[model samples]
Target: MTLQSDQKEFRSWLGTCRFSKPADNGETVFGSQAVPTECKAVVAIWADSEEQYLNVLSLRMERYGYGIIQVDDIMPAPAWMVLKARNRTGPVLARQVSAEFPFALDLIENNPISQDDNVGDDKTLKVIVTTTLHRVEPLDAQFGVFPRKTLPEALTEWFFGPATPNIFANRADTGNTDDNPSRLYAVLDAGKIPNLGELLSSSGLEYQCLFNGKTASELAEVAPYLVKLEDNNSFTRQLFSRGKEPWFLWDRAGGIFIRTAATLTELRKHLRKFTRINRGKNDWVYFRFWDGPVLNALLRGMKSKPSHVATFTQCPKTLTFITIDPLTDTANRFIIDQKRLAGAKKQPVTPAALIDTVQLETETQVSTEKRLIIEAHREALFTAPGPDDASMELLKNEIPFLKTCGISKTQYLHDVLVFLIRNDLTGGKLSPEQRDILMHKRNNAPTKIRQLEKTVSA
Candidate 1:
């Protein structure tokens, strides 16, 4: 299908979306819009590293409103085709899984150009990513697909800060172990429920059981119903709901898995995690947790979870060479708070209130300069709205040419005098001779104005 069709189908599958109001009755201040749950299918990839793949997976999954659960000893397949397979009978169908990415090359090439553009396009550059998904044996426990070079370290650092590389790297190293030690896997929510049993059973391969629980075998029974290969390059994971229900897809032994109480909640939870891969800050890994059963399932299922070492240290150290603006400073402060909440080592938290106060004081100094400019303009107005006879009564009734010029402030008074002399305005205000002199200076400036002023005054 075309992008339009894809989007349309996606929205239908996603269900009616809803957003939370500001400061809604939730622990978190910002409200979130609900993501559609009825995924058509899910895509998975066997990327090179969990860290790098997370970023990539986050992009793809987030696009379709999917989430990711870290699976131990299981690597996610790259590019699970979320859409239906067009024609399985075709010979090409045997080699690849899904349709080739529409603009893979154009996308990759245009990335740098977009980044340098600095306008809105530059922001897209950060969001667009390359993920390496693998078409590998289902039973094999050791494999990764994301190309290392595709991981843009500099770009990640620039957009997310220092911690991002390590977070990516850390995620990459997640699934590996001693024997079948390193299993790499991540899941995508297609937002449409598909026949998981038919998809898996038709793959012509035995389901690889990776999770360990009382219902492990029973869970495997439904694995096929929950997943499908759209083509060689992609596969989809699906879960449909009757009403409020919980759906789970996890490793058979004990590894990364995701479960949602409600189909919609599951999809939203998965999408939240899925899209978060690219949400890494300038240098740190900061992920928000999904409330409810998804969180409980992850805590219960995973044998071991990832840590945030890279996250804590990713912050930019006090710089001797660089200066941070308020925006960057706000981010830094937020990172500090996030790390603290994540149970990382504590750091000095510069209260935002303090920062606000400092900013206010500094702004006052800047505002003073502006005030002076306004005052100077006001003084200049005295020339146009001439001084009243009440003040001019002392000096001759002649208007001061400098004041009459309507240039405000004492500074411009000197400039106007010189301006008059430069034009050979040698006549004084009262005498025609002086008036002529003044007129001479009026049409001249710099040299003649200064010289004539001196000659007349002498």
Candidate 2:
């Protein structure tokens, strides 16, 4: 809001606050506050490590009232994408994500572009992020994702040391488990985590976005993350301790905790493949295997519930998946199937990335199309939306009928299946013309469904 419009929210208090002259000991005071760092934002920052980055985040929020929303360390921005981005003029942050990133940076800074600046060749590149900041909000909307007030004064804050990741994780770390034999990682659903981007910025915890290489810029802000806890760092301790309030790491969004000997890099590459799967011919859909019951059923029901050790650990056989029930300390364990570890997708999980919305088919007396139909809505069938949506038996019954109706599209068959479950209708109800419309790809299936729904409602 500009002063010309006389916006009351932003009063003209330019001359109201001024910095006082430095004292004999060089203690600078501002107005009646007698301090300057209390409510301030940092301009220059040091973000070499994840821990240092956390401090940088707090300074940005406490001073500026805006918190970081999305920080992604792994976004597969190739050379071409980077070159294309360099041509643009605004908001294209030439991050340390790719080798070609430096060229773009040089162009932006108007510096002489050089090959010598092309650094960051390690396993993972430097972190670049995206965020949505808010000016101010009610305390309720701002819970669990804001920087805490510095106690006493800024003098005491610096005189001592920096704070822990969050209020819950700051205290005694009774949850530290560095000695645990199994290296643990978690797949957290970003969709369920509350204001995940803001939480990451202020808390200063490190995480990896699971959607790598495939998507445009990896869609880092909304992918399931891979949170490796073997380091036994403060982030790990914080997550374990956060079981009570804010429910940070130990959230139950159908994601699983992994126990694998594979190095973070190896496991990431291996797991990344399973994010999307062969839904149909060239059509691919996200495979959310991290969802608890879905994974539970997928592994157990699969005929081959075996662990591919060489593919997983590069040595001995050691790979197991665990699922935790929300609000409880107990957890269930299982060995995932080897068959479906061949796909990947977007937007998921908490600390550790979750992906591979996967399924397993049993040696049942069913046709190929029926299995495909079942696999298409695997998560929903396992956990139906409501009581009326419970149509496993009805769906099973209608699969063959749907096949006979020549309704090849999974979505159309699914709609017809639901209609059969809800209404007292048979294969006879669907008009031949409607079936023809649904069966043909060029025809609009939704319009036919709308007509059917209208007819039923009438």
Candidate 3:
């Protein structure tokens, strides 16, 4: 199994990252699909932005523990990923990929990335910075001192415009190509935008909240808003035009966008059909299609079942979905051409009345895929940082023992492991209280482990 982490966001990737001397920009990692756990593991450090982050970082690591790291790989993050996962993945990734810098420890602190220099980069888009270190020999020979590549111009232009291109750019109809179909609009989660409802109210742009009618009055602040943008519109221009007003869209990506020619009311009705789905429980469940990756899966589900596509999509022309996975700094534009799909367009089904048994079954299958994607990202969100190769080894051995204690939740389990690694809990003798706290049935696992996580984090 291969491990990758951007800062402390630990995850399991399906291949190896081999580090030799500085090669083609960031395309350094290589080898077979499966990595041998026993082979000497290599660590690569990166700085994702076109700023001082990398320079400041590598200088810091240069002074640590015999100063074994060399800073030479200044290639693009996409190239790095291509070489690393080339076995299983192809060149589906576009111009956007991240690179980050070397790390330091005041025993290695929080946010882990430096945010001190926020002058002109206030609205600069961010990509997660991943680094790894192992107990490999001749570490200095493997790494060399070089610059890291900046985020690609084409990808940056997608969110930001050509003259004013960015991830934080608020301008609509900026990046459309000849292949793009239908009108585009984004359903934004209000939580990410400061005073989102207020902004929408003041702006002349057409918008409708996810929770409309009665729910709109009560849960407006919490609801996601579907916004339709017009080119050069004053309200849209103001979103990212403020000097250095942090590139908010690329920062959190709190929602997803849709491409359809249907009017807002009709489009909303088409989507409302799937919002309330009946799983095995026989009760209606709210499916959050507007939030990031699930919409991608929802579109995929609609594509496979042409009947649902016909029944739901209001526009007979085409329906293309664009979702940006902030986690990977990747944006996927999933298209469903209605003209190509089989079956006649069915009448719009109200949220409550769309509950046919066969449709419900199909919806359940779609929900399952959505759930799996959500779980995988959730699992990858919180993992303990590997300080050394030995920590990783101990971590693997410690998991089975911890499972016996009922710590199965991903974050909780990792919390316990992080505590163990940091405190050398297993290497040294455990206090009776500590041992009891871990294994005791009366105290309950979550409560006990939560306290331990606090200490580890502290």
Candidate 4:
């Protein structure tokens, strides 16, 4: 049995570029003609663009009944699975195998990972800045290295000519690659954009166009929009201190790279007042807040073009609602809505509503009172049979000796004791001698009422 089990586990190989579906019975995989006998698991690594990698990993885990866990920089040995090969025309064998993370490369690097610095202080601003550059006209372009100090020559030309000299100089000044500046517009979406006008004016940075390629001046135009603070915990401290928000670190199949998402500070501030926030294991973030008030305010905002307005004279107290959306899908559509205190003001909309509100009283107290009365009646039935003449008749009937011993029935009270004495001497079984001795014992028995009472009490 053990050998057969080993063969079953080791029958298939590690999947490479493709995956196989589970069998019709949904117990295990069936198509293994293409699988190698010695393989157990497959591993793959992707570049920094995580969008494609995340989808592939999620699919493989679901199809193979395997779990997804983080692995280290150094990958596993590719050829370590040959011990499970099966013997043909023989009993089956199964072997157990699993994925592993070796100790050497599994440890995370020591380089500092940035975290949020915002706390009780709310004045700091963090912004997602997007800049749009337009050319006076079109021109040809080429890539060349520029000196670090030159106004435009030192800057890397993102787009070639066919653009106006003024606009080309502006795009070159900031190292911007997009020729169509209208397509790239920046906004203060999540973080604080503190005193935007001041930052732009103080640095003399031109939002329209810059003749001199000044990276610092352009950053100054963008800086007021970013959350400002002096803490080391700030995520953009290195970016802010070095004056390089627009520098390209590297390039991949997609394009140039920079970190420009909503800062953790902005996200927390937006979601803090919400009643619930769900961070699911599938890498999604959802929020639920008081919806009734927000919806009415939104309606008012729609009605008034340039200013805030009121949609209703007074707010209702009963209705409450919330929403949920995934983090990756930022287009703001809710996956679920939980409503509380719903339709409280409606007047019997359905028959079921009326039934739910009906009140009924309990009958337990009344039933308990009737049970006690029945018990009292049962006690009255046993009171009539007193222990006197009836008791004397019953004793004589059971013993049968007093009537034959020539004792009067009135004297049965005395004869009862005499019967008891003879029965005890015969060990509760009557003998011929005990019957003859009964008369002798009867004369010796207690005769007076007071003496019989004393003997009975003893």
What TM-score, over all chains together, does every model reach?
0.17, 0.34, 0.46, 0.17
Candidate order, lDDT descending: 3, 2, 1, 4
Q: Mind giving the per-residue lDDT tens digits that candidate 3 earns over 184-222?
A: 577887777667888788778899886758977776766
On lDDT, the candidate that comes out on top is 3
Local accuracy of candidate 2 as per-residue lDDT tens digits, 1-458: 01123322221000001111112323223222223221221121223322333443344333433222213221122322332353332223323212221111111121221345333221111111211111111112224744532211211211123322321111122122221224566676666666555555555444566785666145545567776653324444334333345733543342576665556666676677666765546576677666655555454442221122113322222345665433223344443212122221222222122312233333223433444434434433453222222343545666775566456577766666555445545435566654564465444546656756776686
C-alpha displacement of 122 in model 2, angstroms?
38
Q: Candidate 1's residue-wise lDDT over 42-148, tens digit each?
A: 22222333343335444544443333322221122212222123322222222322224210100101111223433421111111112222221111111384331
lDDT of 4 by residue, 86-189 (tens): 32211111122222210110111212112342222221111111111111111112126222221111111211112211111111112323222111101121
Q: Given candidate 4, what's the lDDT at residue 39?
A: 19
- The Cα local distance difference test for each model comes to 0.26, 0.39, 0.44, 0.24
Better of 1 and 2 by lDDT: 2
Instruction: List RMSD in Å for every model shown.
Output: 29.7, 25.2, 18.6, 37.4
TM accuracy, model 2: 0.34
Candidate 4 lDDT (Cα, whole model)?
A: 0.24
Clashes of 2: 32
Candidate 1 error regions (>4 Å): 1-164, 167-184, 187-194, 204-207, 210-232, 236-293, 296-458
